[model samples]
Target: MLDDIDFKDYKKKDDIHGTVLYPAVMVAPVQKKILKDIISKNKIVSIFDPFHGSGTALYEAFEISPEIHLVGCDINPLANLITRVKLQGVSQFIFRDIKKIEDYIKKPDGIYEYSFPNIKKWFRPDITDSLALLRTAIMDITSDRNRLYFWYILLDVIRFNSNTRSSTYKLHIKENDKIESMQNTVIDMFLSAAKMNVNKFKHKSDNFILYKNDIFDIIKHFRKNTFDISITSPPYGENATTVPYGQFSMLSLYTIPEYDLELEGWELDNYSIIDNRSMGGSEKSISLTDFELSLIKDYLSLISIRKQKKVIRYFKDYFYFLRELCRVTKKYVVLTLGNRTVDRIEINLVEITKKFLEKNGYKNISSVMRNIPRKRTPRVTSNVYQKPVNSMNYEYVLIYEKNNVTPDREFS
Candidate 1:
């Protein structure tokens, strides 16, 4: 383990990741530092991130190790697209592609290109019309790679124009008066953003592979010991409770052409489908009450039985994922975790993860705490009482090394 250190020394602004917005992006320089250290200690060939939100870790790894194989996945199609575009890099003729966007807008279809429940509530009519026009133009792009970069830029445009308040991650609409006053600047926003974002991802590399499936499902196709290292920042808590990544992304997912995304088992009929499929969100997964951790028992004892169920369900899913993640990874695992609030109490995820990894024949090597720098997530407000509070003040990056022995029971 390295000596106690401050992340402030290694800090550098993200050039590529900032081109598009994503919730809870791992710090790029720190991720690079971790990957660089791992590569120096061992001969690194490939890296994996199951929860590759916006591809922060993979992007940094790519910057350092251009030849290293990169693999990552996220349930959100928008995330998949963002990371894919980042790894593939934008074409050199990105400006020419922007000029071509005008060609696709032959004539307005006079109707929205897609539909979902209460779509009108989230988007003003004029805004919808302009977006549809832009969507058509993006679709007209002949090359899939160029089309993807345009789509990546459009995600921010869609979110900003939507009636949903950009101040928070949850899908709460702005006041009616505010919505009515909004302008139809979709075309302008898309054009300016496309030009601005095109240059951020111009370093082309094709060795990386990104998946858009649940981590467990994606692991099934992989043989044991496939990746040399795994670097990921899993969600701090259940999606509904913390950041509703699915709900926050609903507008973009629905707006982007389904054919382009090539999504699997994603039903747009309900907005909460992605969040519900998230960890601890499924009904069947929630009913598993046999969590065999003393840390869990001690923590649950302090909270009400009602809230205990939530904690139990989330960890059941988390522990299951941890086992599978360790099984597939060969040498090292670096997890950046956060302790989030549950019923006004902090859940010690850092300690919990250390203990859990130990059960799977692993030992902690490095643990460092870093204050979140320029975080986009606002001071979290409770939906129940409309109260805002400081949250997720810091994050812990825990590094673990796998022991040689394979077989051990997971719990006491």
Candidate 2:
């Protein structure tokens, strides 16, 4: 029984934040506020985020309630690195000393290297060599935690020092551009980030953990009825191919812990990866059925013949993922998601999620819609934004509760 508060009134004015590597993230501050309001009612002993992009939700949860044990799980290794660095406080000594090591590497005959094929393409020869040296120096240190901290700093500076202009989230290197000085820039930024992170714990106690594992698998490892609350903003249906997560984040991943593991393909063969249209024309649509109709209408109007199959794939994958999400949660589940329009077809995820939750023995206790104000950025083509109408800006905090959970429920 979530009330329809004025969407325009709750509009968030802050900048939309993406992760260091994953650029497709649409984090509106208003949705975060709504989530905080929902979480305030419960004493969340174990707060979990399956799609913990940028670690904003976990960080906010930690900042608000220090006693809450934050556990974040993500498929991307770079995301895990970001979460780990943000949660685990770094000592000042480690931060200060790392600068010396970084400076030494700038000298001739620097030590270390990652001769991975992919790594070679992105970085200049000297830049790659220098980074390899830095990587070795950090790894040579005995403390695993300190090494992780150093790794995060080094990764954070990759995009800034490269020839790429932040075009979308992926590295689109500018042609005929000089290689930016990687040495001083990378080292200085790392030191600054270290200082900022350490300063956070000077007042409050540090207690948070990040797991570098997929959410679907991580749930199997957890005891039943373990988490008190789950909060996350998962990918939209059509985002897999349209908004490629791995491609955007490959550079960042390489800079952090180089994963030797196989990357799970969520496309083609997998029915779990879903894509769909966004919500555009149906600003007035209310019911789930109406939303679907609106999305289909928009789909017919906007996309080319080539993308027709993908639109269907997006919705199917999304629905299945929702069922899995319902299976894992213990009590409270808060999803921050939005309507995505693919080729003008509006995808109303809230309705789809509500049905899925009800089918999975949960009740849609409440929801708060937050309007995120949009800024008209320079589009690649002038004709793209020639129309007065543009992308709608709003997301939701849908709160579902597991009313059927028993006290004697077994964890197996």
Candidate 3:
């Protein structure tokens, strides 16, 4: 570990390459600083992120402490793939393989042959053919790491080459005129992205361990007190109508054959599966009285009956997630949450999270409200009770330290 180096002095070297990897609400740089500050207070030997998202938290952690054992879990395969690539570090073998793929792109052997449902709707015919060719070439690579690296490149290609508008999370195709003006080809985009990533990832490490499974399923595998620090930003609002993470990633996820939803027990096939399985995605009901945040109850009463259930269900999942986090985290957990609106009523998620954590044997150290810089999420305008409502502009970072007096319980 670079104990002599000042972690606070370090700054991001490549923001563009980092943000383009995946589209989820990223933990802001300031929030990362808050997490690092908390980590600095303790002897941090291991780090965990239950919702890895684009793996930015772990990436920052590794940058601060290269030898720290890092573990992350995310339900999205694309997230898992991106996290693994980021943590595993780029190798010379992968770079050489990327070079070979680049050379082959100059003189392709056969016509593109891959197809999937709704594929043409998202991609122009020519663009589809080029992407298929790129996919085949990437697959031909012998190394798994190299294949994943190229696959990551393809993800960027799909997003740029697709007919979908860049601003919206939902998969809405651009107007015909906009589509006609788009001149970038899949191969060109893929090669450019690959080159940029290769240049950025010249240095590699092997300290990270990632899992492509649900947080609940994967948390069971970890023993008690396995992590020194945990930092993450869980999904906010109703997954279906709010932030459709799975839907946003459909174009990229469809390209990976292992994500076939038709396969038994394949949950990823459903486009909204990630959001549907997210914090508030379930249909089960919970008593409003069970929650300590009266503001949540007030918001529930203000929103439509249907949305009320979603709010309650989300907290239910949120509560369970906190319990698991409390069980595994040995010292501290940093949670960054946004205060979204339900029927124009501000739901202070940080306050609710604070209550939940304190109840689960965690001592709340502090809650810092931070302005969201460069918010990537498009402003959501939804009809609640036939009136328009918008999400909040700021988020809060809640720092919680595990109460040493309380013993860790086995997560059921």
Candidate 2 structure lDDT: 0.56
| Top-lDDT candidate index | 1
lDDT of 2 by residue, 228-269 (tens): 777888775544434445455566555554432224443222
Candidates sorted by lDDT, descending order?
Answer: 1, 3, 2
Model 2, TM vs. native:
0.71
RMSD of candidates 1 onward, in order: 4.6, 7.9, 5.2
Q: Which stretches of candidate 3 lie over 4 Å from their true place?
A: 1-13, 16-21, 259-265, 284-295, 385-387, 405-412
For 1-412, candidate 1 gives per-residue lDDT tens digits of 4454355654333477777778887878778877877776677889999999889899888888899999998888878888998888777777777887865565544444766679899999888888888888888777788888888889989988999987878889899999988876788888887877666777787898888887767776787888888899998778987778888888988888888884885646588888888777764432333444665787887777887887888887788778788888887889999898776677899988888888777877788887775665755645423545557878899888778633222211
Q: Model 2: which ten-residue window has the lowest total lDDT?
A: 274-283
List candidate 2 segments past 4 Å from native: 1-36, 99-103, 106-110, 118-121, 178-184, 201-209, 220-225, 238-240, 257-308, 373-392, 404-412
Superposed Cα RMSD, model 2 = 7.9
Which of the predicted structures, 2 or 3, would earn the higher lDDT when compared with the native? 3
lDDT measured at residue 158 in model 1 versus the true structure, 0 to 100: 91
**Candidate 1 vs 3: which has more TM-score:** 1
Which digits, one per residue and each the tens of the lDDT, describe model 3 over residues 226-328?
9988888888776776677778877887876563222225554566776676657765453434555463676677778876777778877676677778889
- Residue 19 shift from truth in candidate 3, angstroms: 5.4
